[model samples]
Target: MTISDYASLLADAGDYSGRDDVAHLFPRFLALAELKLNRVMRVADMEKTATVPLAEGEGSLPAAFLEARQVLGADGRALRALPLQEFNSNGTSAGAPIGYAIVGAAIRVRPKGGENIRLTYYAKIPPLTAEAPSNWLIEKAPDVYLYALVEEIAIWERDAAKAGAAEALKRQAMAGLGLADERLRWGNAEIVIGGLTP
Candidate 1:
């Protein structure tokens, strides 16, 4: 569904709950729902790869980055994730980096040098807005957005019963989305147990 559809549904919800007085806050509810979704949902659709150029072993993370999955060197070697303290104490030897650490919004690679790094990470969901209208989450699972918005609105209106019901539905929708993502990612893969295939 597009942002308009979501807004319309939210309006209907507000009217149904006898809370139309808070209609001006529908956009805020949607924004809050998106924030909650970003914190809770991690699926294949959110995975992104970015090439970051380092200057003196430090580079800014992608704007959409949520969490890094892997960091690779220019030579395609995976860099080990190191603790910030350990990475700092590794000394400043100019060359290729073997480890990296996330420091705030930047990545610090040990063995200070200038090179390009590939970062694979979970990205923030493209929020639904007038400019963007919709995203994968909306297209694939509108119920998730619906229930999440409902929950937020219910909370704002101080309706415990509505909030509780919406929260339960939201959880179910989120779980279903996760399950669908898992099936798409690994349903055909073979399972291995110890040294044997299962």
Candidate 2:
């Protein structure tokens, strides 16, 4: 389903098609929907990898980065991210980074140097738009998106009954997501326990 499709459902939920109050809030609803989906499930589509330049004991995370899953060196060896105190204790001039730390918006590495590092992480899902009418949530499990949007709208309108119904739907969608995730895990026998399942 597209954003427009979800919006149509929302409109029919409360007859909001022409209501300026609801129409104006559709964008906000969509934003809330994406946020909720991100919180509820991790889809393969949101997994991303980016190369970050390490300099001055740090590297900038990608703009769309949500949370780091792992960091790898040029040779593809996993680099452990260090605790803040450990990284700080090692001092900024430490030769080669044995680990990294998420310091504010930047990644602080131990033994900082100039090397391009690979960061694997969950990415922030792009909001749906007219031109870019769909996303992972819309394609894989639009019910989750639809229910989340409806829940947001219900809360915005202060309709307790509607909000409760939407919440139930959201739970149902989450259950489906969990089953899908487990199925993927079960199908891939050689997958690393803590690594990405393919």
Candidate 3:
């Protein structure tokens, strides 16, 4: 999945509608959970460039996955991201039709309050032809490419929600005295925990 694949839909985004705790970003997280890993395999089987002509078309999954392999070293695990760039369909180069084997995009998390978290995703795409995945193509156009992009954005929003909730929890905990430490202190009313002795 591209960075936008998750960042756009992440619940706690720069412009999240539900800015509450993770509770508000539930829709975002659900979107992440909704994205299926199997989509990659689906992308791989897409029609080949040889068959559909450059005019045919894409898989964000394949492109992103391949990029992941290169960046993450093909360990086959999803990488945690700190978004900086979101994938955007540059759109075909006029009269180019769909000139990609598979298209991949990003859902970037732009640092608003000062965080550069990014997530990038990749996918494979086959050419647009009868051989291309039947479910994604209709008539002669590759509408499936658009669907893939939208799906990626939704996933990004979900991840954002998770990040926001976690950040809030951390803030709340750090701002208050922990109960465990107090209990351990017990009778040691003025114990020196880590101070240097003069």
Q: Give the Cα lDDT of each candidate.
A: 0.85, 0.74, 0.31
Candidate 1: tens digits of C-alpha lDDT, residues 1-198 = 233355655665565456767768877888898899899799999999999999988999999989999999999999999887888887566668999998889998988878999999999988777566678887788778878888998898789999999999999999999999999999999976677665
Q: Higher-lDDT candidate among 2 and 3?
A: 2
Backbone-clash count (model 2): 2
The best-first sequence of candidates by lDDT reads 1, 2, 3
Angstrom error at residue 26, model 2: 0.8
lDDT per residue (tens digit) for residues 104-178 in model 2: 789876777778888999888877765666666666776776677778888887889888988898889878977
lDDT value for model 1: 0.85
What is the C-alpha lDDT profile of model 3 across 1-198, one tens digit per residue? 221222332322323333434444444443342243224332222333211111112212323243432112122233233322231242322321211122335222111111121223333432322233233222222222323323334445566655455445433432232343345456467756697867
Q: Please state the error at residue 13 of candidate 1 in Å.
A: 4.6
Give residue 129's error in model 2 in angstroms. 1.7
Candidate 3 local distance difference test against the native: 0.31
Off by over 4 Å in 3: 1-141, 159-198
Tell me the number of clashing residue pairs for each predicted model. 0, 2, 56
What is candidate 1's TM-score against the reference?
A: 0.88
